[model samples]
Target: MLTNKGTLIPIGGNEDKGIEDNEQYTLEFIDDGILFHVVREAGGTDANIVVIPTASSIPVEVGENYLEAFSTLGCKNVTVLDIRSKEDSEKQASINLIKAANCIMFSGGDQSKITNKIGGTEIHDIIKYRYKNEKGFVVAGTSAGAMMMSQEMIAGGSATESFIKGAVKMYKGLGLVPGLIIDTHFIKRGRFGRISEAVAQFPQLIGIGLAEDTGMIIKNKRCRVIGSGMVIIFDGRRLKHNRHKILTEGTPMSLTGMRTHILSNSDSFHIEKKKVKILPIEAPFI
Candidate 1:
């Protein structure tokens, strides 16, 4: 099933769930994509990694900061592409970066900007193609960067704000992972309500609320929590609602008998099964 918003509707079926129990989707979530996370994992070995910093709202310095961080990852050869500029120079640079990288990281910023800038661009297509061909490429993001991984993004704000109708105003995401709605800065920003609203709008989709400094490593349809925060899984597959007239914003709309699971770092959750496989800890690694 697919949502009206163009996101994959979470359905109960073999195909709907990415979990096969035997296979795992291998992905790494780093603080950023290059120097901090991917490079460290590389351990001085040369590996392809792409960095998308559109969410950073600044220029990514490849030689200055990125190189230094990448060295720690033991990467001898590194290429950094700053897609934020999207100028002719940057576009060409982005093409080269995507073509060479084994892993792609999307930085935190306004998701709308990131998607608009690179969604359908050549860079995006190249990365997708490479990843699909089993180049051992891992894609990751933080905050807004993470939001764009899902087919349906959480572009709407709180119910208190003016809602521009028409399926929550979503743009074309990178489509790295489908059928899931991802939100960042979850706990700190009190974004549960917003994700809940998204579920109400599309109950078929599983809502993943990731707290700051925390990330969910998705492999083979199952998610492993990694970071210092909590990940809230909102499963509305069994949601029930009452018909009412004249629904107003922030009127304490009641959702009777809705259940949510809170998972912390190193914990795991199954999207299709809608169940928590492990419990989270108080102290999670970054």
Candidate 2:
């Protein structure tokens, strides 16, 4: 097994150490928003992989130069989704790409742009179909890409005590992972307050804050922390007195019984069991 502190696990290797059986969805969280990499996370060896960078604002280069590195690693075939150039003409290309691959990767860019372009289109429909019907197709993304994986996504803004009508927004995510909200660049961006704001708004949900170069892999509803930085989990299922008499901007509030855990590389935490299980440093590969 190969591990990198901040970057993604190298592509094109024929190893199945950490992947789970019957796991059709491989979700990768990139250090940067909208930027991520995914190989065949499911199915037999030599699964086809497709990359979609529709969220990017700039033009993307496809073909040899674009996919040679990963293809050389082990990916049987690689294709890019250039949805911006010819929205109508490329529709078939996008659909064909999703239909042919066992893994799909969303590139980094604006979350809104990605969702707007591919969320309800034929390509999105095909991706959803493969995720549910296919046995081993995974959907992965980086920063913005990571945010799109959750049921609720952090639209924008910084950490602070102030509030705005739509300062923090929630949208329909891809729903590959449910009940959890993901935020990247956690520590480096000082986004705790923003996450806190989200928790305050939706007390029943779990807030996952991932530091730069850090990621959490979910299996059987349990999250395993990966990479060099830390994974901050805010569990507010037991919070009390959330309702305020006069709720307003910058008002003082107290949230009691909210649970938090600081997980380092290789540490595991269970959401439903409400327990944190630390793994041995020398544990064997999965």
- Cα lDDT for residue 131, candidate 1: 50
Candidate lDDT scores, in order, read 0.58, 0.59
The sequence of per-residue lDDT tens digits that candidate 2 reaches over residues 176-208 is 555677777788767776776677677777888
Tens digits of lDDT, candidate 1, 1-286: 2112111111110110132322122122223332244344323266765555565545343223445445556666665566654463246766777777666666555788777777777877776675555424567666677788887887657533332223244555677666678877677667766777666666777888887656665655667776566788887767776221245544555455457888775688876666687753554444
TM-score versus the correct structure, for each prediction: 0.73, 0.75
lDDT of 2 at 15: 15
Off by over 4 Å in 2: 1-37, 40-45, 59-69, 85-90, 160-167, 244-246, 250-253, 284-286
Candidate 2 TM-score, true structure as reference: 0.75
